[model samples]
Target: MLMKTIFKLLAVALLFASCDDVEPTIYNGNIGQNDTFLSFSRSVYLLPVVQNQTGEVKVVFNSSTVSDVDRVYNIEVGFPEASPANPETFTVPASVTIPAGEYQGSFTIPGVDNGLVDEVVKRFTLTVTNLSDNEYMDNDTTTINIYEVCPLQADFLGTYTIQVASEPLGISAFEAGEVTLVEGDSQYERVFNATVYPGYGGNQQVTLAFACNFLNLGQSIDTNVTCDVEDDTKSLVHAPAELADRSAYDTNDDSYFELTFIEDSQSDCGSPANTVLTFTKVE
Candidate 1:
């Protein structure tokens, strides 16, 4: 009797161990003929190289399976680039077929510049499938290497009167108000107001000329509005007429511009950041 009881106890212990090693094949209503996961493998594509400045990207993944489960096998992938996540989940048709051989799922991805790494090279992949049993699969993977590009600046060289509008112009900027082609004639009907820098600048006169032809792309604007740095006595003449007729100039990229009494500070007459001042039409 003692021997029989020991044998029975041993048998129960072995059965429990086997149960522990085995994955639960059935849940409340999952893993049935309508809920089995298909065993599969797939390939995904990440950007060969990423582009910067925009900081956005898109990718795709293709997956397949060998023995499809019951209902249908939902699919998903993982990406190291975005966030750490669990296996992706999807719902399949109740009578979906794994084609008796293979299953496929292709995903399209979209992203934005998150300031993580601009124009940088990073990598990520897909996490494959999620099982209803909480047990999931991760296999599909891809990589993307990003490269950042800089934007081109603008040129702002000419004679002009500076105006303040909606937003502040980053560099020493100027805006055109009206054009008097010559004396006693005007083009636009805008009101003449106080100059931007009241006391800092000279009093409003009959005509003002701005020579900003030297301001071009890639040039830095002079911060201090001075007649002449060395000496105020050697200050160049201020032209207001041209300043009023300043043309609309902008840089391909967000760049700087200059507005100096003397046209000695501009660089790259045509490139972004530099412009030449030509205050003609001044009376």
Candidate 2:
């Protein structure tokens, strides 16, 4: 009878302890937010289709975290590169969600005139509080990189007209039929290259190099009319009255006369020398 009573008393004590160990109800408690929260995935953006000559960069926002958050809060984007030399721009949205949700807004990037922009994202952490008691809550961070693209240009490409042997060249024997310049399959930047080829020396077999630069054009082209041996014996051909000048032939030298239109003297023609001449232009 005594052992039975002792066992019954121990049982009653254990029942009361178990009943008192039950947890209390959390009736809309402010201390219920005791979990770990973190936000990542920040990126820079280059807005395309922007044709601003001043080299200003426009950025776009992608905030997809707040909607999954448990508390009612507000998130704002800011730049740390703020204050006289390193000031940042941070414009907040008009309102915050009483129950916390994702939000967005836009503002211009100012004071950057150097055409080079390396923008860093400045994020403002959203704080949560009890609707009844405005208490501080936990926070998270994110970032973005904004930049500008420069323009490019290549070189000068075009065409030009050319002329070789343009002004004139003097060949003592042959007549200058034509004066023309040909590019010869190769494309030259300049229309006329007076130094490239020393072309058209009508001497020998007609294959002369273009090594010379200066050109000689005859002012007057005519024929030396020899009076068929009879005029040579009479010596009536080289009279100063018939020709233009006496200097056409230098009696002091035995070389042939190389005369221009303005230099012709009626005294230059003799029955012993008869030859026809022609002329043209080359640039």
TM-score of every candidate: 0.22, 0.20
Candidate 2 minimal-lDDT segment of 10 residues: 1-10
Candidate number achieving the greatest lDDT relative to the actual structure? 1
TM-score for predicted model 2 compared with the true structure: 0.20
Per-residue lDDT of candidate 1, residues 30-117 (tens digit): 2233333222221222221122223223232212223334324443333473533222111112222333333333233333333443
The segments of candidate 1 whose C-alpha lies over 4 angstroms from its true place after superposition are 1-44, 48-102, 129-283
Summarize candidate 2's per-residue lDDT along 7-76 as a digit string, tens digits: 0101122211122111222223333352222222112222211123322222222222233444433444
Count of clashes in candidate 1: 68
- The local lDDT score (0 to 100) that residue 3 gets in candidate 2 is 11
Q: Provide the global lDDT of candidate 2 against the true structure.
A: 0.24
